[model samples]
Target: MSYARIGKGRNLPEQLEDDLRKAIVSGELAEGQALPTEPDLAQRYGVSRSVVRDAVRLLIAKGLVEIRRGKGTFVRAARGEAFAEALLLALARNGGTALDIEEFYGLLLPGIAALSAERASSGDRDRMLLRAEAYLEAFGREALDPSSDGPGLLRALFEAFMNEILKACDNKLVELVGGLLVRMRSFRDLAPEEGAREGGVAAIIELEERAIMGLARAVAGGKASEARAFAVRLCELRPSLRARLASTPAGDMPKLSFDMLAPIVQDS
Candidate 1:
């Protein structure tokens, strides 16, 4: 029995916790549904009632379930706002530096882009193209002015790319990573005008447009390999872009530093 596996001097509480967590996430125990009574669960799992209680406590600690006094334990809603806040807090605690965030991006974004390129639908392609066009327009206007909406535009484009991945990856782990990337990106304070001034905003915009178009065309044409390669190349350019931004002057925008932004940008 599953509960017996926990009780045989084998760290039963932890094992039960894992099992119950999986069951909740997989919908074996539906959201808001009460868990079986401690005695019932204990009997079902071949464990003591105390072990079952310990498992419930563990799940509650993880925010996977809620216990009502004299009621029972109930599954929590999936991706609840409270859960998001807790997850972000946990990430922030673990993420001590910008480099840590960058390392995370470095690991995930390219793969997400590749998968997006491989699986995006026509609507996704159109949405990405529209965002790319908007980015180009923002770049052109912000090239001359120090105060350009370049970062905001770039964020929108990032979302366009990310939405494709979230829709196609069909993996919760990937989705969670993508969400973290977005959160990190939100905290990124890049001097886009400086990068535009130094590297020619028009040229950067063209590169971004090309990347978006490349992925769109590849996915639409069912060219998965080409899509994957395009994504890899795009990811490879991010490091160079960060290097360029780091070297560029901040002009009037304080002594804005890229070091702080590097980790978030570099996160895989």
Candidate 2:
């Protein structure tokens, strides 16, 4: 694998790490490919085996490689679980509430929708429309049985639709952030505000579903700004939704993690 021509400024280990990292990120060192033996790397880089080991250790900590003891050190796909946990913990420790996450996601959704509109292929657009319709249908069934986990099911379908949009956006970091935000909380978590009427709740839910359909249509039609505007319109309904769903019983929501995230995970 090739790295940039060496400059003699950094410490030995750091320099080696930088070159190896470049190689891996540039796909010169392919994923799941084993690295050369320590002595071989040492000889190739004109460094001692100890320096090579230190560099490899650095790569391991960066999630760029895995050691299999008797097997060898191979490149690994990076996962965001540790990053997500650390970030979520940091938010909690810093006194960030669920509303903070909600607002954060509200700000992110428009861009995501716009990106989906701009980037999605015809097949992706078709899937986006299908998922959006599924979510709308699920939401309509929420009032059919309050005792059932209808709200939870609706939430799942909504997440699945958004996951499709996120995937269509073709950005891994954006997808991860959006996924984390959705998991932070839902409308069911909001306190039931007094004077929330059934009529008002139904109206708000209808409006929200319409916005979802609009977003999907905009994406399918390649109307980026229209998709973004639909997303913003959806966000605007949140305050009303908080009041509307205030009377929704906790029992109406899912009690455990079941198949809610299965769609996204399965596709991944």
Candidate 3:
């Protein structure tokens, strides 16, 4: 295993933490790889074991490493766990409302789509299109049964599709902020808006299937402008989002927990 060159600086522990974090994030310390023993790290960095322990503690807090009982500390694949935690804290502190989230998306998601169009590899594009296709197949099966969990299924599918796009975008910031999509699903379930039409759940599913297909095609075709435009069009279909965006509520908003947001399966 390669060790970072330690230079004299501020707090030795903090500098050690920075060095380790950079190594982990840069793939030098690969995921699941065992970190050097505390003694080895201390000797390598010319620091005391206590300083090494402090640095390891910081890495643990950041989700960069996992300490196993009787096993050594191992590097973790940093998959936005820290970002999600930070965003949740920020949202809670700032009184994040549904409209606030939607507005953020209005600015963020289209850009994400455009970036996906520009940067996505062929495999990434194929995977995105495949997710849309899978959604259609799942929706088709669900549509035949009046008692099916159409809305719930669609929510899952939509989230999955968007996640694929986020991955395709190949941007760390986009991937981090993309976590809001999960919270947005929770917000949508908060008040439970009616299906977009009288034709009921199946109709709603059909419309969403079409919209997602259009989005997939634009993204896969590598048309950045069209992909972004399609994302805007998809956002317009959410009546609840529109309503939330139009008015800001007064006083402290009710706290929303993603845990309580159950999938809405209604009988037609």
Candidate 4:
């Protein structure tokens, strides 16, 4: 099939890539469908084979298509990993910090929790409970053996527990954003301080763990309001993780924006 000839432009490869991307997004192209071969695409677009190859490469990097050896290129059902990686790269380039991600997630977690409560399946609830229980076991082991892998287990469990909750929310867009948030986590916050100073960081983390357990139970019991309450409490209690971030040098990344949240995190 002939595509409209791309007009002369600032960058031929980029323009071609954009046009192809639009076709993919708008479903002019479809998942698992073969794309025109390079020579054919080059002829159709009135571009060189090299330009077609470059455009296809860009689409591949974006996770839109895969080139099969001899079989040809096919539109892919993008899993969002490449997109997530690009977003995170942009965020880091713009000096996005752990605190920035935390605050952003803070704004969303309560709502996510409420939605999960309303929609989570029994399996989701069961998995969440398991993750919560595993974290507690890791926490106890960490206390007893400082050098054990328990700390690492704690971090993994933390991410897994959040992943489970995000999945339970049953919204693919939310799950993607939440997955980014999970990755954006420095894991430095295996602890938070907001109102947790009185209880101490470790104490606060344990309390939050119990709340997670409670949340899973609430979801199982079909209590959306209770789930949101647990999330809000966890949100209000997580500022301590920011304490460590505060003292850490900004290093090469530009230091801007996060200072505004500094006072709020400190006040918490």
State every prediction's TM-score relative to the real structure: 0.54, 0.62, 0.71, 0.71
lDDT of 1 by residue, 130-246 (tens): 655665455446444546564566556556655555666556777766765555544324554344445454454455557656665665565667766665655452455454434
lDDT (C-alpha) at residue 150 in model 4: 31
- Give per-residue CA lDDT, model 3, range 1-268, as digits (tens): 3466565768888889988888898898899999999999999988899999999999998889999889999998867676666765676577765566656776787888888988889988898998899867765565444335545665577677788889888877777678555545344222223222344555556565666787898898899998898777665524444454445432223233221222222321
Query: Which of candidates 1 and 2 is the stronger one according to TM-score?
Result: 2
What lDDT score belongs to each candidate, Candidate 1 first?
A: 0.60, 0.69, 0.69, 0.69
Please give the range of 10 consecutive residues that has the lowest summed lDDT in model 4. 259-268
lDDT of 4: 0.69
Give the CA lDDT, 0 to 100, for residue 178 in model 4. Answer: 88
- Ordered list by TM-score, greatest first: 4, 3, 2, 1
lDDT of 4 by residue, 87-136 (tens): 77776677766556666777898898889888888898888888878866
Q: List the residue pairs that clash in candidate 4.
A: 192-238, 192-240, 193-238, 193-239, 193-240, 194-239
**Total backbone collisions, model 1:** 14
- Clash pairs (backbone) in predicted model 3: none
Candidate 2, 99-122: lDDT as tens digits: 466567779999998998999999
- Model 3 stretches with alpha carbons more than 4 Å out: 1-12, 43-48, 118-122, 139-156, 179-198, 237-239, 242-268
